[model samples]
Target: MATHAKLSPSSAVRWLSCPAAPLMERGKPNTANSYAAEGTAAHHLADQCLSFGYSPSDKVSKVLAVSSKGIGFFKHDQPNKKDIAFEYEVDQDMADYVQEYIDLIDNIMAAAKAEGFFEQALPLESITGEKGATGTADAVLITDKEIIVIDLKYGQGNQVDAERNPQLMMYGLAALNEFDVLAEIESVRLIISQPRRQHVSEWTISADELKAWGETVSNTAKLIDSLDETSDLTDLFAPSEDACRYCKASAECKAYAEHVHRTVCADFEDLDAPLTVDDAKYDGDTLAKMFERIGLIKEWIKAVEQATVDKLYAGESVGDFKLVQSRGGRRKWLDEEQAEATLKAMRLKVDDMYNKKLISPTDAEKLKKAGTLGDIQWNKLQDLIVKPAGNPTIAPGSDKREAIITNPVEMFDDLTEA
Candidate 1:
């Protein structure tokens, strides 16, 4: 059996849950993702500002300015400052979104202030578990009510939910032992703020519950260490096609290799065609035409598959069609001059009086309360318009899961060992 150091709680869960992911991680060695780098830089700056106490330094100001410009500021502290970078860029028209993020933090801070729970943010600590395993948390907010642990994620994906996150629970356990205020700790709140989507998710778990979860993490670490180095990856998780998309080891994994080979063979068969002696006479133009036809066929097949899936899931028809209710000819009403002349005789202008704000708010309210206006017409009068196109329905017969290969040993070995 190969004895390897127990992986971090986060990495262990990822490796076990998605076996192929580690292989994928190993394959991309030199890809310098700038967005990731920026995120890391921003997070580090935020951690320092919150932990060491905010200073008016250029670096701190720069980060705060950038964060203020985006949707929201995410808070978390992790080491390997060089490993992960926080790099989520907001769309150009994201002023409102960025303000919302600031508002969320402001609200939390306000609550903390009102409760007298304010303290230095993200106080650092080296937590030592059994067998000298150690890890650090990003930020720790102390309050009169409870301790708040905030984690900032710059990624766009929704992988972490506060309720199910083991890392947050682990941090709570570590804090309990380190601070010796486990009894004073009324509750541990886990906050995950995603700035890209302007989303915030929080989970509050009791200290007792977190302690139990910590024990589970420790036991799982021990079990993982007991596994032999040569143990088949499939023993951990069943191999499947969905694994291939994000698998680092897909290039070398035997299962993935076989699948790719089969796919290639099938494609080759599709390109094969019967040829006659005279077929060679006009080869160039014919070959070009064949390629064009193949491209169109591929597009059609994809569209059909998508439509089928949409129909199955959403129970809606799919295809191009013009609305039958659309008119073909122009229908004219009274001319502006004629209408105005007639209205003038009655001492009323033919202008839109409703748009002119001629009616008082009291009158509008009275009219609305009287129920004389039909629901649809009333809503329209109030400038409430229903969307012409409803929400899109997923096509029926669409494959929900893409093909995946579970075993990543081949790919991992190739990338790492090589």
Candidate 2:
């Protein structure tokens, strides 16, 4: 009998969200990063150990015994293709870190067991669909009450929440049919585990809702598959600035390259605009103040420019800025070493004076009896002194850090509040 094809939620989302992403993923099977591979391996091992009591073989287990303590690892079948090989020298540190991660898996599994809602977890399974469209889910949890699907993310980007997840629901639909437990499944729970941050987010939806989501995914996949070569698919996937970071074809994508170039030119154009001066109407004090303001503005502009250059070199964002003010003249401060030496010569350790405490009669008696004030001992101290707070001295064209506006509406409300 021919096996029926299955369409997973992950592929569906990629296909729907960014048609280009799925194309790239399918075309490049071995292009996944180490983090992605590690996450997959960890989740595979976890599901095996939790659901079927299958642990890693002794040799693989030994390798994992020393990995990162917080990260986990388990060996799957060796890759059919080798990417790289190492010489036969033992690296004890690497071995230990690997084992640490292996142990972390045990800890995570233990916690999952303690929760006691699920019966067994299953590792990755290929969900084949029509026209060669297919994908694999990280893991699936079988429970008396519900089916839970999990996706492991090694990246440090935004957390994936289930309410918006199409992949988990796709897994739910496939699993429900494959297990013949459509009626038994009360709901489908999707979880995203971010190992680096040690965080997990779960979203749950009813079986009916999952089925509906699956249909939507199927319809989307069908739509993409149905498109002809002549279709102008530009509107199918909109170009986004965030996608530029990891998009495989970003360098060659005309939309992305043009967008970036356009933005850069626009910014330069804005900066090059002429600055006008109106000095004819000013008189005496007004003229002097205006001149001073212009000087200050010039200094501020210099500072902002320097900051922008630094950020650009550092691969950081310098969104926008306007000059504010500049201070005049030189400033000096006492050297820390000189000040500390002088204070020591006067028979005073900075800590002693800084932490001197006056106790009440009852507290004093307690301290004397104890030969110490238990909680009064200064454990740690550091000095943070700010001087000349009005304006900072900086070179020309130096950029200053700009403040961010988090909630414009909230700020407006606050300003108008009675």
Candidate 3:
């Protein structure tokens, strides 16, 4: 099986817009963290459920080993692989979350069956198109007239939408190309299932539209493939918030840094010059425009800081900065049992030996998910859960949230009263 495609559908948004990203990101060390490993485990859990005809609950408490090789299954007790990143014991929370995704697939399967679409496939791994490009559709259901490609976004950081989503669109194109011979595929439906975020978004496009988009994708891929390591991609780079958010090369890429500089500095000729707030340029309209780029600027700043730390750790000199241990670390018991026994031997009271506190509402919700809390009991508990109004934050006009209106007169009166 292909480990990862050069122009993978998962990174279509990154490459399609910023064609230079593929070459720029090549050979960079992966910075994946525990969250990524957890996501992989969750996907493996979902796969096991679908393939073995078993619910996630059935595998509760089972050990899931995630490594550089792949996810380990049964008999993973004694894994010989030394590259094991981490092993996750399937908990009720994980099982329940994976079950939500399974439930979505089950519902889709049932609906497809009703529509006379009996043929189905879990994880269309060989959905190849544009020569070197490929994608894996989490689940696919097909009929004579329709094809459904479902992708599961295990991450809950940003809410993914199906509307004009390039990743799902690429998946749709790949799925259509792969399965067109099996049926008269007229329409392709792209679905993104994000169980943790309680989001399931889907969009449908005609086969003609999907194919047309695929042609554009093919052209971009061919152009990128034709470029060599020495090729200058000055014009090919397109920097945006979504495209640069998870980009591995964002910190070091000259083009990305220039883009950020241009965005925030605004016509400042020296891109590498130190940033300073020019009071003369702080007009109302200019400030308003700058606010839009604030998020991107913050992301770039964070990326640069992280890159500096990573370089220092790798023994690469970055200016005069040196790595040092952080001060004021939290304390932990060296041996909890031994400490408890010693406390008991000293005739310490139970209350004195241990600290007890009520669990938060979030913990109570976990109990509900684990089936430890019944519906009625959870409902009663929820009555005590208070959610205060969030402070107003700025967002673009296109944001779905209602704009908070301010009353200067009422505010002044309230301040005076206070």
For TM-score, the strongest prediction is 3
lDDT of 1 by residue, 1-418 (tens): 2122234434444544544345445535432345545555545554544445543132322322232223233334523334323344432223223333334555777778623122222221222233555444555566655766666665674345667575566656666565545337767888777767556789898877776666665555545545464656564542333334334343445544443443333333343443334434446555554443443334334434544554555656546532235465776545977866666777864474224656654455445645655667566666643336545433223334344545688888889987
Report how far off residue 133 is in candidate 3 (Å): 5.1
| Models ranked on TM-score | 3, 2, 1
Cα lDDT tens digits for candidate 3, 1-418: 3345777777888988999998889888788788888888888888877877888877888888777777865364575757777888888778878888888878877877623121132222333333433455677777677888777788998788887898778767766777789888899988888988888888899999988877787788788888889998999988887788888899988877888877766534344566666643666676677777777788889899999998898999998899988886789879999988988999999999889999988789878877899999999997799989988877667557799988999999999999
TM-score for all models, in order of appearance? 0.44, 0.46, 0.85
Q: Which candidate number would show the highest lDDT if scored against the true structure?
A: 3
Provide the lDDT at 241 for model 1.
Answer: 36
Of the candidates numbered 2 and 3, which has the greater TM-score value? Answer: 3
Model 3: clashing residue pairs?
none
Per-residue lDDT of 253 in model 3: 80
Q: Compared to the true structure, candidate 1 yields what TM-score?
A: 0.44
Residue 63 error for model 2, in Å?
A: 3.9
The better candidate by TM-score, 1 or 3, is 3
